[model samples]
Target: YTEDEGFVYLNSIMDLYSRKIIAWTLSKTLEVEEVLKCLETAKRRRKTVNPVVIQSDRGVHYTSQKYKELTKGMIRSYSRKGNPWDNACIESYHAVIKREWLNRFRIKNYYQAYQLVFEYLEGFYNTVRIHSHCEYLSPDSYEKKYILEQTN
Candidate 1:
């Protein structure tokens, strides 16, 4: 995300099943710490009983020692080389975020970009925007429906 000040990187983790953004962190730089922070936030937010297999592109930030150490007990999966489709969901999401939301605003700084993205994820994307794969339900609705089916 490029603001008037500079480029800001937005790191996010989405729940694969529902296409819901479980956690995110925005920073001015692509430091390994930002990646770790996003993962940690996801872990704390989800607290899923099922084992987690984090699928990420083989970016330097993901390959860093800090990330490896932080994910000590979690499963880490990487997209296959030369096959970006393996992670198409998240990849497509990046485009949608930029196209459908961020591009609409002339973000002045990191704060402005961050606030807009935060609103998009919480107010619109997860709650209002529908996905065809989810039977045209928003991600939050999809997750709730899935949970209901499981419990019943």
Candidate 2:
């Protein structure tokens, strides 16, 4: 939450295969609509005919009818109640981003927070930062290698 914005929520979708953040939306509300927007963005960015399993915490937004409707063709998995470890990857991502980047800034408003998030996600995390889960390559590089291997 930003100082002036009251409560800013970040809804993100991660592709577990490469640990890439496929899409994200920073919104002022925690409404299911925001989550829907994030999902839509992910769908637009990553075009795939194969169905994928989407895992999330049992948040009200994820459990909503609208969310279910939009994700009709995909499998949905929810974390056991009170067990955050069930969705550890995304939980860790939220922790890492705050500890390494967001914690360092005095975000006064929503726009500032949005800018910081964009820089960390697009400029660094996806393109430059190495992850052991990705075999020490950045998410983008790791994904490229995987695609290249599939074609070859």
Candidate 3:
């Protein structure tokens, strides 16, 4: 969904296992550069060559030269011609944000919105949102639980 303040392109990398957002970026336009920036943020945070399969809609930005360069030989790419369910996880995250955050609040400017997004994501969503995939645990909690379960 596009925001009226601007284009407000939101890019997110989702963990398929727990259906959690590991990384995300918000920008005023849906440029290939902005998309690459989101991917870079995810890579920096994860700091590993994990075999991540990034699925996105058939948007030009997703298929652009810069985006392909970023994912080249690093991450697998998947897309559907016109199906949203093909990338359900991140799509769902977008819906959640709109319903829970964007719809409920108004921002004076992009900077304020940016900060609010950061707080909503890092402060609340990651650690607090109950997810069915993790039996009501948040993403961080679910990851910790998985680690413990694996180490045992």
Clash totals in order: 0, 0, 0
Better of 1 and 2 by TM-score: 2
TM-score for predicted model 2 compared with the true structure = 0.97
Compose the digit string of candidate 2's lDDT tens values, residues 1-152: 78877778888899998999999999988889999999999989988999889999888999999999989999999999788887999888989899989999889999999999999999988899899999999999999999899999
Instruction: Identify the runs in model 3 with alpha carbons over 4 angstroms from their true place.
Output: 1-5
lDDT (CA) per prediction: 0.89, 0.92, 0.78
Residue-level lDDT for 96 in candidate 2: 89
> What pairs collide in candidate 2?
none
Which whole-number lDDT from 0 to 100 does residue 115 have in model 3?
80
Please give each candidate's TM-score: 0.93, 0.97, 0.88
Our tally of clashes for model 2 stands at 0
Clashing pairs in 3: none
Best-to-worst ranking by lDDT: 2, 1, 3
In model 2, where is the ten-residue run with the lowest total lDDT? 1-10
* Regions of candidate 2 where Cα sits further than 4 Å from its true position: none
